[model samples]
Target: MSKFRKKGKKSQPAVNTAALPDIVFMLLFFFMVTTVMRETSLKVVNKIPSATEVAKLEKKSLVSYIYIGKPIAALEDAFGSAPRIQLNDAFASKEDILLFVENEKLDRSEQERNKITWSLKVDKNTKMGIVTDVKQELRKADALKLNYSSKATDNIAN
Candidate 1:
């Protein structure tokens, strides 16, 4: 009998990845819950013109966007080439501005309602008539805090 027994080759223990799937699923669920997807799809050709001075909104959450532009090539057949007002995801007339403003106001708390800013994203080629009408409608809604969306530019005569 050999005095010293040969050492047995012990296989290394396999890594315990039993919780791997659970961890992956937990991460997936977390992203799904926290991810904020686009709420509205623009149906118009929004080409915001450049401006000499442009100021960014302080609180984006308190701002509601109104898109004004001609219909895109795809939508031209149905909506025509005329400029349209987009409230949320749908085309809205000036008449709808009042309701839209009211709805926006209702979405925010009473304390922050007054701070809500209505941003107008007017296309460059769009005429001023529609914009003026929108402004008047906003006035009726009493949403006086208005902001015009424009790209910043360096050169300005003023």
Candidate 2:
């Protein structure tokens, strides 16, 4: 009787982790299929001024971009130098800008005009005089919605 009872089989966990790799692979595949792609490709390079509180803009808003500095010179002259603002460009002149804005606003119905939003995406190196002039021009146009950006990026905030 002692010899028969002398040894007993040791208990061990029967569950094996051999299937863990397959389970992980399946879960990864499921997530990969369900993931959604987001928009990309808007790259702005400029020093963004700091703000105390940031406000989010609604998805539905009209944004007009303005590059204050000069346009890039010819390819030969474009060796790591800041480009000048091309006044020939739209919004380059205060009058042209105001006219363009007024025209665009006129095209919209009164209801739309009431909700019209004007955003200024000026470059960081923009001259104070130019920015002030632009502001004055916008005011002359009676544009109520004004959003001026000091950053070089695509962020448009109040």
Tens-digit lDDT track for model 1 on 1-158? 34334334555689999999999999999999988798989998899887787887988789899999998899999989999999999999999999999999999999999999899999989999999999999998899988889889897544
8-85 in candidate 2: lDDT tens per residue? 554566899999999999999999997856332222233335444445456343544434543334422443344322
**Least lDDT summed over 10 consecutive residues: which range in candidate 1?**
1-10
Best by lDDT: 1
Separate clash counts for every candidate:
0, 6
* Every model's TM-score: 0.76, 0.51
Error of model 1, residue 130, in angstroms: 0.3
- How accurate locally is residue 143 in candidate 1, as Cα lDDT from 0 to 100? 94
In TM-score terms, which candidate is top? 1
